[model samples]
Target: MMLNDIAMIAIVGAMTGVTTVLFGFGGGFVVVPFVYQLFLRQPAIANNALHIAVATSSAVMIVNAGWATFQHQRRGNVTADILFPLTLFIGLGAVMGSLLAGQLNEGTIRLLFILYMLVTIVDCLVSRRFLKGCEARPLSMSTTTVGGVAMGAVAALLGVGGSVMTVPLLRRHGFSMKHCISHANPLSLPVALCATITYTFDGWGKIPDSGFIGYISLTTLVTLVVAGGIGITISQRYFPKIPDWWHARLYVLLLIAVLIAMLW
Candidate 1:
């Protein structure tokens, strides 16, 4: 990679790392668009730019999610009871979502992503009333499984870490914002892993020779993962100081920024 490209990756990675920990997302929301823009500048990967961007972002999430999960666990934010039951269903859903993503064209995926953003924005805006009647009861096994599958699929399709959906659902089920984020952090692992593997095989022979394995750019993955890891460490150290209301506001701002970037 050129020095300029390396610099770009480092900068993006650092920003992504902070966001990933701060919001409990896998950083795919930020990574996907940035990587898509970067891929657009590379002729060899231009034809499959969206796929490459999504795949590479998912791959990077493997590292981001793992580290963030560890940090959350250390702080006693993760609830094992909630995490264990959803694993299998989430994995299954991730595989299904990746398969579906492999079959769609770039335009369709982009449109879906935009629509998802709109819905999430609306959900966040009216979240208080929407969750008003929800009981602080334990989620049934069946409900967890179904929710896990759906969350995994959508997350993979959009190149996210599943927290965007997971957090809202958990919140409605009476989980605090912090606990929701904590649980959502670990769920990202399955989605990222499954989607990355699927994308690798889906574009195996179609893309040009561009230092890629299928749709994943090795250089981008390495640089972002390393820099993002550093960002996560730094962010975790200061996470306790941030209030939940501030976190909510930050998430809204993030979604708005991403929406504008995509439209722009």
Candidate 2:
């Protein structure tokens, strides 16, 4: 790699590290936008690169989520009973999502991404109502399966980890935020791994001269992983002190910003 490449890696690493510490899961959001901007300057890497970028981001998430789960589990917050079945279905869903993404058009994919983010913003805003109802009752297998399927579909469509959806669903099902995050941390591993593998294999024929293995971008992947590792360490230590309302407002603003950028 050239010096410029090394410099880019350093920058991405630092950004990912900071995001991991602050949000515990903003690597993709950070890397994707930053990379998209970088590719705009080098348009040769732009075409079909988004797919590779998303795949690499997911692959990095597998490692990031594993480390995060360990940290959360050490705190005695992860719930195995809920995570097992949910993970199984989420993995399956991720595979299907990757396949679908391979077949979808770029415009369609972009629109879907925006729509999914909007839905997440809506969920964050109404989370209290949903959680109140969930606290009054437990989610049945059918409900859980349905939720898992929807999350998987959206994740595949947008190349997100599905945790934003998963966390909210868990909370609505009466699980506390801490427990939900703990279990979801491990659960995201399968989602990212499955999706990454599928996307990598499925998009191989499409990506060219992109330093990719399937849809995985080595450049972005390396930077994101390094940065995400740092972020995970911080979130694990300070996450508990952060309020849920603040997180919701942040999500709302992020969604709005993404919407405007995509539309413009």
| Candidate 1 error regions (>4 Å) | 129-135, 238-240
Candidate maximizing lDDT: 1
Q: Give the residue spans of candidate 2 off by over 4 A.
A: 1-26, 130-137, 237-240, 245-248, 251-264
RMSD of each: 2.0, 3.0
| Model 2: worst 10 consecutive residues (lDDT sum) | 18-27
Q: TM per model? A: 0.93, 0.84
Write one digit per residue (lDDT tens) for candidate 1, span 118-185.
99988977888223424566878877888889888999988987888877777767776677778888
The per-model lDDT (C-alpha) reads: 0.84, 0.66
CA shift of 231, model 2, Å? 2.6
TM-score attained by model 1: 0.93
In model 1, the clashing pairs are none
